[model samples]
Target: MTCLPKCAVLELTYQCNHKCKFCSCPWYAPNSSYSIGQELNLNQWKQVILKLYDLGIQAFSISGGECLLKDCLPDILRFINEEGQTRGLRKEIVVISNGLLMNDDYLQLFKQNHVHLSMSLPGIETFAQHTGVDNANGVLHWFQEAKRIGLNTTVNITVTKKNYYELFRTISLGLINGASSVLLNRFLPGGRGLIYQDELALNKAQLNCMLDTAEEVLILSNRYGFVGTEIPLCAIDSPEKHKHLRYGTKCAAAKDFFVIDPAGQIRTCNHSPKVVGNIFHQEIIEDKEYWNIFANSNYHPTICQSCKLLNMCDCGCREVANILHHSPSAVDDSTELYVARPAKP
Candidate 1:
């Protein structure tokens, strides 16, 4: 088996200070046992990270309703750095946070551990509304602090109908704040997001418009030496540019990444409910079924099979296909749901 550079996303805790309108947790489900307050202890986290390293995983991003809420995240980073050194694993650890709980001490901790920090900044004013916060100035302040302290910083903007128009402005702000990169994510229609689907999700045309704007921003970033990181899965226009963006890496979730929930259930992606194995007790790479599912699942939309850009656009998100199409099939030429029509020969 080929050893790939795997990126693991550890959801430290589901509990978040901000209750956004597009929250994706099944918080209100009557039978749902998941809690925002749940978290893995420091020891358990160490074990999981070590196991993943043994399996050829090289990078990891710690996320949550807000990772800073764990209180022990600083210690976790220190442990990871120590363990990673002993194993010869040059792991790139990233902490995905809401930028609310960060302080100068935490920034120094991140610097000491060589940790990259990614902040969620949906938008300026509209994002504040979604998070129920009056202003986004505090988040921006932290971004500046992280940059000043020499921490690699990135901004994640989850685009929705409410703040779609602010896409260009958000990108500009990210650059001004010294963010190394910016990621624009589309709102997934699940959890609290499902309730605001009509208000939060954009139709095909609107999505195209957003992409158009993104292209211009990318050019601007290039001119100013800013690295723009747009989510390819949600990009609806500029298929060629999407292809260029992928370069050599495949979907991060295609067996290249893993998500371990608070209860220790392992999944290939955050959106997947299926548990591949348990980091608490089992080796996921040893499970034949786990590999089979990942190998068999195709993310390419049906139209992509025939499109020249098949390799570039990995057919979108696998979770989308599983949830929307009700199957784990590789979106070959037969699947029409999200497939873009190929140009007539």
Candidate 2:
């Protein structure tokens, strides 16, 4: 509870090109009066990275509405890559993008810096439906190019009601196109996703089917890796069944990770809208007190208090719980929609 974070998510900009229905950027609200309009410039980003490095955070994940949309992204990447080289630090850099803006230069920077890149691809057939773009094929081609260049390639598939059925095809396509891994992300009904939950959120049966498909894919394929993020442990088969699968029983929030928004405000996690403090305004960087307080939090639903899998599931994502239940620690009783506890328990 008193340690530094191993990784930090830095939102370089709130500006994005695509208008995906499930876009979860916390600051993005189309009709809202307030938004995260202020963004840190390239130099400010460099300073923040240096401050994080000084605080012993070795790994960083950079994102944006679309990180590649930033004109100075190459400069930012160059700064981070050059600093990593000069400091001789065991730096782990990752970039998450929609893959629409991916180019040879971006690929070159990734290859030059050992950066791991994950492109968001709901499904090739349904890309336009999900991302409001018809360039799925083009993005896949870019992924192949990135793979050919020896960069770590991954695809992020957000499983929603619209794309749940095509989950396997999406994963298969990504693997066939030279992706080393595919991440099946759960749809958190926060930020923009909150507004589209009725149309996008997966019900219990769909969620199970998605997990089942993912498990089967993992078992059959040995070369490709599949990870389900923010999935309830109870929704999937045992961890022993899949070697590459990763799921969190509890929310990482301020525990294992923290997200820095575009304006330098630090949230417990990317999905969490709760602002703990700003990394620059507060002494959060130098000390672990801010994270420690939230790390030790124990509030939970009454139903979870006696469940056998309580520790294993942590009642799923607290951010989603907060959106539905009005408290991060409360349960939505939507187990019928996702998971269920034993009758006797």
Candidate 3:
């Protein structure tokens, strides 16, 4: 049986604490302005979640400019947990945050609900450079606290040109700080990321170097897991992982992982502009054709159709192609252009 995505990402809020240069928020810009429009209330978000549950999605991830900022967050988590339990669905909840606002009370809620936690780590000294926050180390402490409380923690490092050189170090520090796994994400041009795309984007060579290090980290951190999302599969150190990566590492959009923005808009994923429907509209939710649009759209490029590695990489990321060519369906192998850099021990 083919493994399909069974997750949904809910952008709880567009408001954030850090002014990361590479942030992918649609309305965010460096310090000039933030959170442009009204966001869906807690009730509205619940409706979205309920619809997703009906769709047979078992995994839900809550994110935001900083998801922890919402005062109703604990209630939100509890509601989802309770609803999933009542329905007898084995739901997996994930919370993504910068970790600065995390505390004992929130940790308790997460622990009680069995939520997996992931914190953003920009890099060592480059945290300030990437996040535009001085107290970067403070954010790192949240992961430790999460681990202390027995919550499964994963460290997310958004790989950009500014922090590409420090990728390995960031992964090491994350593991040392008690993170159970590390997810290295390729930087995409969106939100504030578009502001400095040229400067922040990683070249193919640099990404390959990062992947090489990813393989080494997997070997070194035997107990910990490593995944480089949105990176080319050809760049991976092990051909052995390619088959599994084909299904596991593909864009969630290509599968069925839906996204609900703070505004209640349903998208295939954050990177794609195509809005399948709005959760606030019951008619839209009930209409199968609206969702079929997302399911029908083929993200794979024609260039990718003939390759044996087709499933492994899927021609990089569609959202990236959307940004580079102004068409989500266009083909772009930007990863192939970068000159490979040497991997560090």
How does each model score on lDDT?
Answer: 0.66, 0.73, 0.70
lDDT of 3 by residue, 229-306 (tens): 565454555546432112134655736676777787766676655555666665554434434433655666665566
User: Which of candidates 1 and 3 is the stronger one according to TM-score?
Assistant: 3
- RMSD of candidates 1 onward, in order: 4.2, 2.9, 5.1
Q: Which candidate comes out best when scored by TM-score?
A: 2
Candidate 2, superposed: residue stretches over 4 Å from native: 1-3, 29-37, 224-228, 237-244, 285-293, 332-336, 340-345
CA error at residue 63 for candidate 2, angstroms:
0.5
Alpha-carbon runs more than 4 Å astray in model 1 = 1-5, 26-38, 223-237, 240-250, 283-291, 299-309, 330-339, 343-345
**1-345 per-residue lDDT for model 2 (tens digits):** 135567888888888888788887766644533346478888888888898777777778888778887777888777877877778875658899988877898899888877899888887777898788888887789889988988887888888888988888888888878888878876667677767878888777787677677777766676545444455655654457565555556666666668888888777777766666666764654434445545765655676677776666666776667656767677644334655563244
Q: Any idea what lDDT model 3 has?
A: 0.70
Can you give the TM-score per candidate against the true fold? 0.83, 0.90, 0.85
Location of the lowest summed lDDT over 10 successive residues in candidate 2? 28-37
lDDT of 1: 0.66
Error of 2 at 123 (Å): 1.5
Residue 334 local lDDT, model 2 = 33
> What clash pairs does model 1 have?
15-36, 300-315, 301-315, 302-332
Among these predicted structures, which one has the highest lDDT? 2
Total residue pair clashes for candidate 3: 0
